[model samples]
Target: MAAPTPRALRRGEISFKLDERTAHSSLDLFKKDTSVIYRIVGIDPTKVPQNIERFTDWAVVLGDTAVSSGRHYWEVTVKRSHQFRIGVADLDISREGCIGVDNHSWVFAYAHRMWSAMLANKTTPISNIGHPERVGVLLDYDSKKLSLVDVSKLELIHSIPAEFQGPVVPAFALWDGELLTHSGLDVPKKLSGN
Candidate 1:
């Protein structure tokens, strides 16, 4: 059997950008806030005001826009990062801990060359796929389904079904390296089934 080719199924795209206010002190936002790089030196706290929305202990950032309804899709290109988490989470998710360890978030994580799908402290190991350069996220708000795709290979990495409490935003966590986000993308036919 061969992998399916990626094709556009619908025209649902979103204006996704990282919310700098929510970024951790150790992370620096660049590329018009579409990309973030982790800095060991960290930013000077004196320059950046303390905000409750900021992630205090984790290198995490949330999307500026929240999705409450309809279908949406976006992509994240992993650049020089071996450990990272890409997914969606409610706005109220704990800013102190890692994502996917709380009920408000669902993530596809890659760390130490391992892949897993996580939710509420539960980790489901995913095997048989190689490292992906770009990961695509598909959120069907009406259906409450979140999917993670290995865009480089055009493979479905994982999917989660949940009863979202309210609006959710794209969330990312990076311990090392950098990430670039691409938004306003049409939901792929292979994943959207339209």
Candidate 2:
């Protein structure tokens, strides 16, 4: 194949062509080098320590397979560099556990679990947050991803994939919904409709 131009580069198409059964596109993060790149046609997307990049900036890889079965193609870029740092395979495509990240990486300021971003490199290694308190999950309608981040930092991270992912999200019509999350372990395992 040819070298990759930005999604907004060549033909105003924010997508690349790939075969799901053969080769797959992906995102590679080099925390040590401070760089992020799309491993597909070999394109660098983020500069080291670009302040705005996070785990969300990286593409969602299903297990060890790179290819995904879907229709759309897009990559994520950090707010600072504006480079397409993470080329997501097919976000809206769901494989298992809501497949692609469908919603926001939920956070509660009062219960800051995703605070690994605040660590000084030498002080504490940037590993997944280990919040021991929380409830409710984060859901994405587009990527079909659910992050159990509505309360505590979250733990025992595991992915449960499904052929037909869904309305895995619950509705919170009240402004005080998240506030009550601290009541603990009330997160619904099955999506609302289930």
Candidate 3:
């Protein structure tokens, strides 16, 4: 399917910040908690207090807000990162393992110079068209669909259909770069049927 224009995606944009409590120890969040980067010299695990809500093993973080209904859109600017996963996950998704390897999360990943959509340990390779500096995500809750877009090229990377059990939050995992999120945008005119 053709991807909507970036202007159209702005219609459904939402505002959210990363939830520090949900971030992994190796991730450092800044820019009002809307950006995250993986730190080579992570905070000593022993110095950080234990929190069951924290992502213990993965360099992942979740948005502070959850989407329970309607259509929403957000974008992530990947800066100087070669390996990362961007997607949404259920509130109850496991924090131990990687995001896309479990049933509760779905991701569009860029790693090892390959792009793929992953869920529940299943991967479907996507043809690479260079790399995107920005990724746009569309979550149509009522439609039960999640889509990833190449923001600069205005191309659809992939879309997934699923029966979301409950509210889901913006989820991300980074290995070597930084991510800055953009939200509170209007849904694109094309997507809004205008």
2 or 3: which has the higher lDDT? 3
The digit string of per-residue lDDT tens for model 1 on 60-146 reads 998887787888889998888999999888878887987899999999899989989899989999887667777788888888888
Q: Candidate 2: lDDT over CA atoms?
A: 0.25
Best by lDDT: 1
Give the per-residue lDDT digits (tens) of candidate 3, residues 60-129. 9988777877888889998999999998888888878888998899889899888888989899998855
Q: Model 1 off-target regions past 4 Å?
A: 1-11
lDDT of 2 by residue, 2-32 (tens): 3222122211112222221111124443432
| Candidate 2 wrong stretches, greater than 4 Å | 1-26, 29-58, 65-111, 114-194
Find the 10 residues in a row with the least total lDDT in model 3: 2-11
What TM-score do all the candidates reach, one by one? 0.89, 0.18, 0.89
- C-alpha positional error of residue 60 in candidate 2 after TM-score superposition, expressed in Å: 2.9
lDDT of 1 at 28: 94
